[model samples]
Target: MNKFAALCLILCAAPANAHPHIFINAGLVFVVDADNRLTHVQVTWEYDELYSLLVTEDMGIDADYDGVLSEADTARLTGFDMQWIEGYNGDLVGTLAGQNLTLSAPTAPTATLTEGKIVTTHLRAVSGAPQINGTLSFLPYDGTYYTAYDVTLPVLVQGGNGCEVTVDTPDIKGALSMTKAEIGALPEDFDMEAAGLGDIGRRFATDVRVTCAAL
Candidate 1:
């Protein structure tokens, strides 16, 4: 498989059920410098228990059924190559001042099983420091609809002077309806790749808008 396909398999493999195979409750922490310029974003994803079990079993972790995957287990699992595909626009999208913000490669990726759930965290640095004068919008989703993203926490802004943040979550129902309608309008034999299925999910994703007050 190609690099993009391999990465998609881990995160966006479509099942026959017409619904997402994995469900993720996600949260974001926006890291800013003292000058109120965005620096990095910390993302946390919590997976459902069923998916967690599948991941543990597939990765050959929790060998003794001890409920906890060892440090080695965590390391091995985290070692999966998740680097951004060069031509692929990643699942996470961000914009500031209506201009797209480039998110660099992910760092400090960690995965752990806790309370029957798998939680992972990764930090991605913004390519450049962009001051958030008004609103910063984010959408996280797998375009194939193979994975669903639901924001579980407010957007946290850390280390920005005089910056207060408010998170506005989009309506899931409305977004879902929009995606379904768009997909349904396609021809029965429509080619997914040609139709850009890999970029469709964002249209239905719940937006995470971080609006800040004047500094």
Candidate 2:
């Protein structure tokens, strides 16, 4: 084709030529203290995608996607560890009761973009308000009957623009450990509401507001 036609083709093929999947709900953020150590993270997910993976074709914790996980699903999830979690949090708060993650952060935070550049990101949220089921928890020994506390809370989350986070799956042999990142920078195709290859655990933030709480 002519020069102009060839240029048009290049632009048209750009979007698909890069990323593999059509991400819907995915995002990433990095919180570094004065010491440069990575702090906490906030992730929000696409219910449909999550349900499809954990649950079945629209069936996981809440098998029917009716806002509430099935009794059997909840029962089976007890004390079970979720493998291959990329941005998985350690402190859980909403489990053992078979309900949506209700992580209510006592406080929020105010945000400020540091550098004038695109901060690569890969982030998401697991549980928040308007959600009815599917959450993680912590198991503690009571010296008799163990107790699980749900830590799926919505703390004040912050992020920068022009950021992207990505997953680097090394082709090394042995145990293929999933080492996905959502901090220290932005992602390759970080759109805040879209997921890409191998970022199945990535959740995007919804109604992302970084205002200080009035508490």
Candidate 3:
């Protein structure tokens, strides 16, 4: 099975109380043109140490288990996480003025091992280069709640003068309460594979909003 399918199976099979298996610290850099149009978003993801270790071992990297990668190993690891199954959206949702924005597939991918963790970055172009006079927002999440993302890193609005970036964290207590209630209502023999819960992680996501002042 493809990586996405395998991830879904593993996550969907877990009990609702179980936490996300993979953790990522994510950041974004919004690239805008002189006309205040958003051209692309540079996204960064730093994998948790445990997940990084698993990936290295699975790929037979770092043969000596020294927690350090040689130049050849680093080259081999580049873009390792950029492989996306069809229609996977890269777990990032972008919107402008409450309307969904089309984002191109990840490009300019780069990856490195830092302190025994995998740090990767990629660029996603905005399909239309939409002008951002209003609000542009992004939410990083795994709909299955299998991978948790925390916007704990820098978020910048590059090349957009007077643009403000804000990150809003969700209400964890309330979200957890609602999620528990919904899961509790499921039938005893309900099949998650047949009918999956929709975007549960959306409730717990961190909102990254950018607003640019009119020239």
Candidate 4:
């Protein structure tokens, strides 16, 4: 929790050499027909883009989603999302089908954890028309490459209805845990003029992806 607060303070300052930790909240609604199959998804990942210092650098270390895992990479994850989180031109790999989604290393966003590797937190899937809000970070690595995602998403979680998870195993890497008041109470200087964050933190949902998930 203290770390989360510190992150907010640093972001409010927008220091140098810091990665942009941002939340490009997308409203994802998985649609299915009478049968269980992925039909459509309403994605809106571009909302109230802010200067998340962490989002800028942490997600950039491994342009490749292979998760061999790296200690050095974890160190670099610090002080990220404090500046300007940029945008990219890529898409998440996993597929979502009728109340369920699939995640795998060989697929799009299984998240292997090596220098460029990822991990399989292993949990995916949800119940009918679940309301989803996620973030995307534009992170570049080795000073020239980049990637994006909602590091917040977990592998396995209690079904939104509080039932034990049967399928859709969730991976909890980098999925921070905090309370709503804790996050909202974190110190921040939402002055787009002072922080120079453009339209950030101005109109609630219009600027950042909030309100829905936490409620």
What ranking emerges by TM-score with the best candidate at the front? 3, 1, 2, 4
Question: Could you say which candidate leads in lDDT?
Answer: 3
Cα lDDT tens digits, model 2, 2-76, are: 422332233224332322122223232434233222243443222223323443332244444454435575454
Off by over 4 Å in 3: 1-18, 189-196
Model 3 RMSD vs true structure: 3.7
C-alpha RMSD by candidate, in order: 4.8, 19.8, 3.7, 16.0
- Measured with C-alpha atoms, the lDDT of residue 94 in candidate 3 is 95
lDDT of 1: 0.73
Per-residue lDDT for 64-143 in model 4, tens only? Answer: 43433366655554323222234421233322222223222211122223232222211123223334332211111111
Write the candidate numbers in order of decreasing lDDT.
3, 1, 4, 2
TM-scores, all candidates, are 0.80, 0.24, 0.88, 0.24
| Reference-based TM-score, model 2 | 0.24
Model 1, range 1-215, lDDT digits (tens) per residue? 54244324433343322356688888989998877789999988888889888878887888777778777988886735365678555578899978999987788998877887878888889987888887788888877666788887556888887666555565656655555555557665666677676465675576777765566
Write down the TM-score for model 1. 0.80
Clashes of each: 0, 46, 0, 57
Model 3 — which ten-residue stretch has the worst lDDT? 3-12
Error of 3 at 7 (Å): 12
What is each predicted model's overall lDDT from 0 to 1? Answer: 0.73, 0.28, 0.84, 0.29
1 or 4: which has the higher lDDT?
1
Candidate 1 residue runs with Cα over 4 Å from true position: 1-18, 81-84, 178-182, 191-198
Top of the candidates by TM-score: 3
lDDT of 3 by residue, 1-215 (tens): 54344434443354544467799999999999888999999999999999999999999899897878889898889899988999999999999999999999999988888888899999999998999978899999998777889999899988977889989998866766666665556664555555455566787799999998897
TM-score between candidate 4 and the true structure: 0.24
Model 4 spans > 4 angstroms off = 1-18, 49-90, 96-148, 151-215
